[model samples]
Target: MTPLRPPRSPLGRRFGHLVGAYGLVALTVLLFLAFSLALPDTFPTLDNVSAVLSNHSVPAVLALGVTLPIATGKFDLSIGYGLGLAHVVTMQLIVAEGWLWPVTCLVVLLGGAVAGTVNGLVVAYARIDSFIATLGTGSVMYAFTGWITDGARIVPGPHGLPAAFTDLYDSRFLGLPVPALYVLALTAVLWVLLERLPLGRYLYVIGSNPRAAELVGIPTRRYVVRAFTGSGLVVGIAGVLLAAQQQIGNPSVGMDYLLPAFVGALLGSTAIRPGRANAPGTLVAVTVLAVGLAGIGQLGAQFWVTPLFNGSTLLIAVGLAGYAARRQLQRRRAQPSRPVPEPPGTAS
Candidate 1:
């Protein structure tokens, strides 16, 4: 008699599924290797890695922040403009008004929160679509930025700023750069919040189905508003960091970061959870872009290539996410409506 074949265990199946979900990471690694091989000493150096991390940190943070709103089924296009305005406010407070850096940071953060609140109200109470709401607000914020700076960069002297303040961007920790550490720490905190917390569950539930969440007494409105507010607060922090790193607040700077931030968030949805915007997924996506862009830049690629890469990645990621979601829905619909029949004469 032929030997009986053993059934695959549930754990093995789950492990395979997990591996399949993270295939993007493997692709990212392969791309990194390709670039490393092409650029040799230039692309794979520690200094290059540090520069990529430092340059990408602000966008990574903003991407993570934007993930919350996206997860809750809303978009905040205002983040770029908010960053521009917030940075200007921070610089004006410190250089023009002579306020302390700490106080200026606090006030700018609060201003961002206010902007987010306005966005939330427009979406939740005014019954406007999130994209439209944020676009309108973002335009207003851009105008404010222009008015504040008069379309010029605000440069501050290093005199009144504390070393610790500048060190937030400049210093290194444990042989790694400070901005990289900040990204890692922020990723950890956000990962825990999205993966382990009750609020996280609520956010997901609302994102998946707001009406159902509301019917179940989940306070969907409150959570949605909170997500935007939290996103704004994070953008505010990023703006402060950007000011520190650049030592100038230019009206044109913030929009340059927006494409990468959205690309990161959208690409994140196609990995890890395969249709959900999660924190760790965003980190991986950001890492992929950072590595890719840094490598390309090191190769002396034209500046336009960066946007081309980001745009293509964003489209592909969104397409993959949509396909995955459709497959999930189909599987759910095709699930067996009744239990399979046991052997003849088994218990009825």
Candidate 2:
């Protein structure tokens, strides 16, 4: 992981730190190159790239979704269940109830918001641990998911789904997959929100030091709620995209993504802005996962390998995230302290 060399000069020191901060991006490039070189006939093709982007885009969205809750130092374990519920609900409305796709999407998004609100309320007001609360809510969501589809897949009508609807996922914008564009757009929005916006600043403050944030007049509870709500909304977006992309409602598919999303979010906190969850960092982490998985799958990895990879990565991500946080704290402690000025009257 120490890919960059430490330099003695001041400017070189800064450059080295910068390189360390964004090493994941460099790893992404190296990974892509390695796979391309290793699987010359398959991995280098545009079709392969397009397929990977299209397939992993939903998971990327989910990871981005989870990043919000994590920012507030709260985990929304319900997102996977929320995604499944949203997916099934989308298809059920469209196919069973004969609702228009636009309306269905809107309703589902709103439902997602409501679900998030519930999570926020439970954790913020009820004093439930976010982990336990979200897990319980997620299970309820899954039960509703099964109830909606009766544990059966929701297939489209004889005419299939509306072309315009499927086009949400299937269409290309300038020869690139549209879902990939969604990830980029969401990333930019989150980057602006978390890195540049006051609201995001409040959440980060709350995450790093809740009592300090409250003493400074930030509404820590409200912001934490907002964080989970945002995560829920993103989960809905992913679900909508999943329905469009899949064109079938598989009641159990949502759990498949839970690991990778967490993996991406946790591992992401170790890069770009180490010790803090960030949009660009999450994207870089997801890219690494996508590339590595694709390369291995192409090399004839068995079906179980995907889960194994995700599971192992999740463990590593958790460990690295803990280490990064401690390292950051140590760095702060090691910094030279500035002298404080005395009160004018007292000094006189």
Candidate 3:
């Protein structure tokens, strides 16, 4: 008689599945290596890494903000303009009004939350399509931003901004830029909220099927509003940090971040937790973008190269996300349904 052998465990099978699922992360690694090889001296250094982290942190935050709304099947185009407006408001309150920095920060953040609430009400209560609603609000925000600045920058008085205020973005914690820490902390908070909380589940359910969520008594409208509000609040936080980082309200800086932010959020859905927007996945996506951009810059790429890269990546991300979703659906369909068990004495 042949000796009995144990069957393979699910762990081995899951390892293969996880590798396939995390292909984007693998691609990121490959891109990093390619850059390091291409620019051996400059690309693999700590200074380059620091620059990438410091520069991308704001986009990372904005990406996280948009991720929340996207999770609920909504989009907030206003985040870019809202970021500019919030920072402009912060500066106006500080330089023109001479308000305390801390107090000004609070007011700016509150304004952001209020902006979010308005967006929520428009999309949820008014029953407008989120894309159109946010686009309208975003345009209005840009108008307000331009009106506030009159097409000029908001510079601080000769005394300069408070050390504490500037420190929020410029200071280092554990040998890394403080804004990077903010990114990590926010990612952690969002991960917990989305992956480990009831609210997260509700949002995903609504995104997956609003009608089914309504049938299951999930208060879809209220939750969608909350999602947009949360996004607004996060965008406000990003604006504040942007103010700290720039130390001047440029009015035009916010729009530059919009494409990259959405790209990160959308591309992220194809990895880690495929077919869903998740925090860890977004972080990974942002890292890939940062690495690729930094490497390209070091290679003496032209200024226009940056936007070209971003736009192309956005298109690719969308295509990959759709492909991954279809693949997931096809795999599910391929699995055999449970066969009806034979009645007693009916088996062959």
Predictions: Cα RMSD each: 7.6, 5.5, 7.9
- Expressed as tens digits, the lDDT of each residue in 54-136 for candidate 2 is 99999999999999989888998998899999999999999999999999999999899889989999999898999999999
TM-score of each: 0.89, 0.92, 0.90
The runs of at least 3 residues in candidate 3 whose Cα sits more than 4 Å from the true structure, single-residue gaps closed, are 1-16, 328-348
Best by lDDT: 2
Pairs of residues clashing in candidate 3:
none
RMSD of 1: 7.6
CA displacement after TM-score superposition, residue 55 of candidate 2 (Å): 0.6
lDDT of 1 at 271: 76
Task: Report residue 71 deviation for candidate 1 (angstroms).
Answer: 0.6
Model 1 regions more than 4 Å off: 1-16, 158-161, 328-348
Separate clash counts for every candidate = 0, 0, 0
Query: What tens-digit string does per-residue lDDT give for candidate 1 at 60-129?
Result: 9999989999988899999999988888888888788888788888998898888888888888778799
- Per-residue alpha-carbon lDDT of candidate 3 for residues 1-348, written as tens digits (9 for 90 to 100): 998877558897688568756877998899989999999998888888888999999999999989999898888999999998988988888888999999998888888888988898999999999999999999999999999999999999888899999999989988999999999999999999999987888888788778967776678888888898888899889988998999997988889889999999998888888888888889989999998899889899999999999999999989977776677666657787433222223335
State, as a TM-score between 0 and 1, how close model 3 is to the true structure.
0.90
Query: How many residue pairs in model 3 have overlapping backbones?
Result: 0
